[model samples]
Target: MTGAADLLSRLVEEVNPSSAWRDSFIRIPRHRFIPDRIWVEDGDDLAVLDRVDDPDAWLRSCYADRPVVTQVDDGDTTGRGYRSSSASMPSIVAMMLDATDLAAGQRVLEIGTGTGWNAALLADRVGAGNVTSVEIDPAVAAQAEEALGGFGVHVVLGDGEKGYPPGAPYDRVLATAAVQHVPYPWVEQTRTGGRIVTPWGTSFHNGTLLRLRVGEDGTASGRFGGNAGFMWVRGQRTPHGTLDGRVRPDHEYAETSTDLHPYEPVGDFEATFAIGLRVPGMKDLVVFDGDVPGNPHYTVYLMDPGSGSWASWRIRPGPRDYRVRQHGPRRLFDELAGAYTWWQEAGRPAHSRFGVTVTCRGQRVWLDDPGNPVSPEDPV
Candidate 1:
């Protein structure tokens, strides 16, 4: 049976975390925080991985570097398979921890303590009493609180977006969940010069890690770095829908043909990241025709649930012009294509090149530097 040490070895080789966090990774057993009945992706649904049924596979999953689904559809079994909470990828957990640049005795406030493993790791580094974690889900929080009981870690049940004001002036604030906007309360709770690390993304993109340094003047600013696509916070989640429900045959649409393909805009990470910034509230999905292996026939759907708008771009083995269909108020395909063109015109800057400055007023995403604002100030 593989143990935590084996997982640590794999993480060290794959992520190569700094020397500061190597010991914490070694000390925290990830399996202890994970539930016995975890969820793994099985086709379009989530399949349960029972520890009693298959202990080996379950243990392997717990130690794997991949994200482990802890809850689905907000713990509603009857609902569609929506991954609500998860134990983040091991490497990403290491990367985000490294980004905190934490030191012993520093007060840390962690948001979205999914499985309490990260909180335990933080406690291991900064002393259990100095770490305070907030989780929104009741069951998840109760389980985490129990797991962390002996560690002296304080687990609060409340909205993480508001942060825990009682633990004010935290030296470091780490958010396990992703957010569309950096909540002002996180900045307010951190002391000046302290760090706030969280996954920031848009409806179109899940996101990248954002490391911000709180300024003396009550604001936080930093650049986007590392590939950290995490689940969105409950409050900022994008509307979930099925393609069949959103795209109906009875719905009226505008038919057109586009020479541009969805390869770069949809497939390329950098392109999709940039395009997501420009086209807000746009979500995408690619559906393959039939169940044939290596089938090139597929359709890319760009949907904006806010305006009941959707666009379908068909892709096949051949043909220069692909069938394009737009429905409802907004023209999603054109917007995506325009955003892609704009990204190209701007020399195709990587997502890391972009940065964000958050103030009492709102948040603004900038490219290259804070002096140049890429988009209009996003009001909080």
Candidate 2:
């Protein structure tokens, strides 16, 4: 019987190719990219992680469409907490490819060379000579170097956030780790008209796929393309606040002039903020807790005042569930409620309608539909 490599050769057809810049599926050997031990979910849920070290199981999981957890909390050795490292699932790699639209001879810059699986794929289509990948963790970079030995690419041992500048003027820049915003450096490194694809966070759950086009002056603009969950690069990891052992489950909506309805994709603040993540220094989050009940509610947040300014809407279902409190220049819950109402008013929703545009001055993102154009005088 054929081995894991043989099985991987068969799974390439699963990615949706129409949206891909290159219609071809990459041919990197799957087994070469995975570690001996990987964290797999115990069941369907993402919270309860189970470690799988068996080569065959790791191989199969590698080929799947999900990104497996590798490292847990910063100091975790048992692999039972927050996921910090991983070899993204093969299909997720394919989806990223689909988003990239890589073509032969096109130069590509890959951020976060976890296991070099993606770098190998970029090399396959763009030519190894054209691919430049960076990783922040020294050990991770070394591991990628070992994995991508034959791929013929520069596995730079540095922060992926800075990007590999030596390979400036790339045709495409892609990041495996989710980013809170599109760094200015990435935009500066790519040629005008080049495409930039990365997983971006909004004031919601996880990162959603983002597509931006570089302008002549080191800035890119675009919108959310799809929903994609990825670990934030070590530097971009969301730091959870010192929870007073409480999470508020109840959230309130704003008074809408338009006919409002219930949001179908409940608790998907991640999707709601996809396009907005391209703005530099933007970080958004929704804190929900089913574990503790009686405390004042913490909430979903959207913060980007350059110096960490933010906005939130809150309500303690326990204290005054009906009374809503909005704090910050931009009310995060109100924005979410607006989007949700827009979705319901327009017949549920579809992922494709979301869009984003980022500028050097400030950033703004829109979802389910491209928002109206803005002039300099327009309110942010």
Task: Output the number of the lDDT-best candidate.
Answer: 1
Expressed as tens digits, the lDDT of each residue in 1-380 for candidate 1 is 76656865676677666799887787777888998889987876789899899988888888888999998889886668788888888888988999999999999999998899999999999996999999999999998888787887999999999999998989999999999889999999999999999999988887899999999999899999988898989999988888899999999999999899888999888898899988999999888889554579989999998999999999887767899999988999999999999999999999999999999888999999999887889998
The runs of at least 3 residues in candidate 2 whose Cα sits more than 4 Å from the true structure, single-residue gaps closed, are: 13-26, 43-53, 74-80, 241-265, 268-351, 366-380
- Give the alpha-carbon lDDT of every model: 0.90, 0.63
Best by TM-score: 1
Total clashing pairs in model 2: 11
Error of 2 at 340 (Å): 4.3
Candidate 1 off by > 4 Å: 1-15, 291-294
Candidate 1 pairs with clashing backbones? none
C-alpha lDDT of candidate 1 relative to the true structure: 0.90
